[model samples]
Target: MTTFYAGLLSPCALACAVALALTGTAHADDNADKNTHTLTPVVVTATMQDSPLIVVTDPKQPRQPVPASDGADFLKSIPGFSTIRKGGSNGDPLLRGMSGSRLNILVDGGMIAGGCPSRMDPPTAYIAPQLYDRVTLIKGPETVLYGPGNSAGVVLFDRNFERYTQPTLSGDASLLFGSAGRSDQNLDLRAGDSTGYIGISTNHTHSQDYKDGDGNRVHSQYDRWNADATIGWTPSDQTRIELTVGKGNGDAAYAFSRMDGVQFLRESTALKWTQEHLTTHWEKLEVQAYTNYADHVMDNYTLRTPDPASMMPMAMAADVDRRTSGGRATGTWRWGDALELQAGVDGSVSVHTHRAGGPPGSMMGYYKDQPRMRDARMQDIGIFAETRWSFAQSQRLVTGVRVDRVQTRGYTLEDMAGMEHMESMSGVDAMAMMPAQTAADRGDTLPSGFVRYESDLSRSPTTFYAGMGHVERFPDYWELFGQHVEGTLDSFRALQPERTTQWDIGMQYHGDRVKAWVSAYAGVVNDFILMHYPMTSMGVDYASNVQARIAGGEAGANYDFTSHWKADVTVSYAWGENLTENRPLPQMPPFEARWGLTYEATQWSIGALWRLATAQHRVADDEGNIVGQDLGPSAGFGVFSFNGAYRIDRRFTLSAGIDNLFNKTYAEHVNAAAASLAGYVNTTRVNEPGRTLWIKLDAKL
Candidate 1:
């Protein structure tokens, strides 16, 4: 396996180059105590507003953007995020404009499911952003207490690991070098005292094949690894107990399908406990539980090469695994001048298994398979409630409700030519001539609601809110085992269950250097699972389900021009309609803008960013739902990035950047589709990568 990943990257790059050359002379009285620890003005975790981080509170915040190389490039800098690219680091995240399973991503709150179906391990590529520390995002469906179906909203990548006071110990480490031959490394550690604490983290990323913007190459190579550990216990001061363990693996190479991506493994374990009793009658109470595991494998000779009409051609292999477990408990109540209450109950269970055989070459190689299909289970149960009322104190009222019960079961112990060779080995030939039934079951009971209204216009610093939400979703697992034609199997058996009714409004303003925010939304969906791709045969691409209607809004602004300079701007737009072929609404996401400028002193800082996009003619011209080619419209581009950071003291810091500075080439209008190699043809638009530079280092003791 590439020499065991080059023997773990040659001693972690020779121990981070001998700790950056013996910490490169840092200590002039620790740079005067790191010049009195500066650089703490960057807040705005998706609005709860508190200015500083260069303003720009909404429009899906992302002002001085262009610093993300993953997590869909930092959620495409907010504003109803958007991504579907199929190159350079598993992209996939589309909000407000929805995408797969309707958003709802969490880490440190569990739930990570992505077993390709052409998704390619997206769950933010198994996270690993230096072990998280905040990345909240809540767009459409506002709030639903982290659990439940999210109509494109809710993305939390939190990680706190409290920092104790006594017997303390800190940690930090990072290294990154980029451009076509990118590289990454990270480490984090923590030890505690004052009652409890423990932590550990690890990460490594690699890249090789990259060349676009006309340079060609493309087939994007990749390698990944992740490790995690956590232990916590706090006996007093509002109790806490936690235990977590994690594992990850990776491989990739797919310039657009025909099988590649050898294996991707993931394992997770979690245990949690929390308590906060402030007496005075039901002040607080909370609890949680979790478990997860996933194992996946794909082959066509591990990362490309053999393609004799792939089904693993001269050599093929396949495997899929799944295991999920969950739990949750909660309670809260407070009354001192109105109401406040919260209640919770959660549940989850998932199990799946699949297997395959190999051989066609290597002298008739070896073969032994059984598990061609049949083994699935799903379950979910929920009960939730939320309330907040203060009908006076500047008007306030929030409400919530939830109820869930979902179930699914399947069993058919291999037969029918191993379920028609596992549906022709994933090319999914309309479910390889169905009729191999043996067992099946299903059940549902879903409901959700929301209401909100807030005010703070009184003292005029501006703050306003309005909300209404309703969601009823069910039918996941890639909409029931990766959509197998027949009009999504009659829209999954006469569809029904996917109701959304939304209306949100927002406003925020802060003074003392200017900060701003604006949010707007409008939704109405009923049985809207929209995904239609007709015109079949030879060009194969079938997916069905219709009935849709969508709208959008986003805006942002910021200005400081002083405190060492600052400026920001943002904008986003979305639209959809397809009331049964009425038109427009095939992977939305267009009309975008972002601007930035920054410069700080006291340590060092510099920044610049600009991005603009527009041009997409909304398409879907049948071809069995065309999987590639015939992407009618697309044109519009702009890109620029630059960053610098310094602060080599109180621990250490240094960051550098350069991204597509002038490389400009672009493509992304919900990209995906680019393989058909025979001189490679098949472009469903997705090519962007050229001109790159990077450097990052951070250390703390």
Candidate 2:
């Protein structure tokens, strides 16, 4: 398996091929014909519309081979997505070499960000994929319909409520068990009649520390639970209104950090109204409003015993919270079925605050005596419009434009006991705050848009398209308030907005025996955000802006050699350079590819998957995104896995898989270094899990 993964495709060739694999997934054909009903482990990638690539998948379906514990783990199955591993769960996701706010992640049209300045919990960490109906990824600065930034891309976890003409009850439930004390249970139940409906979903997962391929334990354990409900009313055939409420809480242990998350609380609410088949030229209308909150608590003693001799030799804890609220209104129009238009206005506002205490023993519980310090406030309002015009029999033009008002403010900083920001670790203000005794506010007017052209070949089953886009991104909380910039910043006003211009193109081909696609992009960026770690030997990782250039793409193909036999191949690659310093941009990963072979039968099926990565030589010491920095070049590695599934009647299915068949000890290049724990003093990339077996049972009604 290693020989096949490492030798079938050359590093340089693989990168080039993936750049042309425009759709980035072998399931493009399946996505095009959505009416078909089939079961697969998961659908990681796909293409939609005429511009860019949007990999869409039904979250209710059980993917084969691997089942992820969180959003980031699931996304890594797709090309162009990687994660910074701190442990088994809560790994921060990176896209096309970009992390943090540049990706524009949204949950049910609302934003909820964790408060750890070090990014211990990114938006993806809080997501439970099974709770949502669909996951959509829009690669690069492809479109303006979602929101701002998107230099890396846009990720959307959404839910769809379908109305019924008669009373009906439906949903799915599943149970999963795996190695390292892994276990999970999930249920999604919904019931309703023609006029109204109600739906509910709940999930629970728990695991203990897992051993690596070498039989050495790693501090990667977690416990979590989530529940949500939706109520909808269908007053008429063309009108519907829905309301949703959700709550979740969890705790986790990490191997590389001094603190563990003792509490992760999430609360959310949303309301949406839709009216279709409107009068005149109006096609539809949608209006929505939502609010999301995150309350997190981290401590050194809650999940692990204190290391008396370590740097953090005592127990410490911190409490932080953030709240975000947003609203959107949109209208759809059509002209003779040849042209379609969508226009809308969207806005969001967020507030962040924190309090910390501890050291010799433990901090005051409940942050009762500590003073609440309001540190960050952000707001955005935008107007956008997009159109699709079929100007010719086999050609179409797609374009969109958006304008936004962005603002950010930082207030007085003081922890419990009246400690100042620069004098304590409250903000992880290790480097120091922007010296703001009084609140400081900054705002900007930003513009972004994209245009795409597509053509369908009449003589062949194929399609082709190209697009170009430009986007201006406002600096996020971590970039502006999380760190300092010496004499140039303190009100942190020196940071500039990120500007990007890129070109994208791709094509897809479908045939009875052959299915394939290629996608590629190249772009230039101005004032790109770069996190410089340990600036001035003060242990501060601060944000800096510099010019840069980037290019890369993904490609894949599948062939059915026989009625019951099939082969699939996929590759992904990315390249970047710091124009100002002429060095390779930090944290860029090496070539990666996946190969799979499978056989299908009447009641059962089996498959094998091989994942490979090339050794990376490019390095920019101590430079990367907010989550982590590049340690150095990493060695290449590969792993082989196998899976099988059987239908146990009409309503139930059983599936099992063995990962890392050889128990090969390997680590990913884009990962955190080993912690300096007492017994585990070595500092190398954290090894992946050893050979393990997993089984899952899926049931639906």
Highest-scoring model, TM-score: 2
TM-score of each: 0.31, 0.89
Candidate 1 lDDT tens digits, 21-139: 33542432354553475553221222233321112222212223333345666666666677766666767778756776677777788777766555666677677655676676766
Per-residue lDDT for 435-455 in model 2, tens only? 436566789999999898888
lDDT of candidate model 1 versus the reference: 0.66
Measured on C-alpha atoms, candidate 2 has an lDDT of 0.78
lDDT of 2 at 184: 76
Which segments of candidate 2 are over 4 A away from where they belong? 1-52, 359-369, 413-436, 483-491, 535-539, 679-681
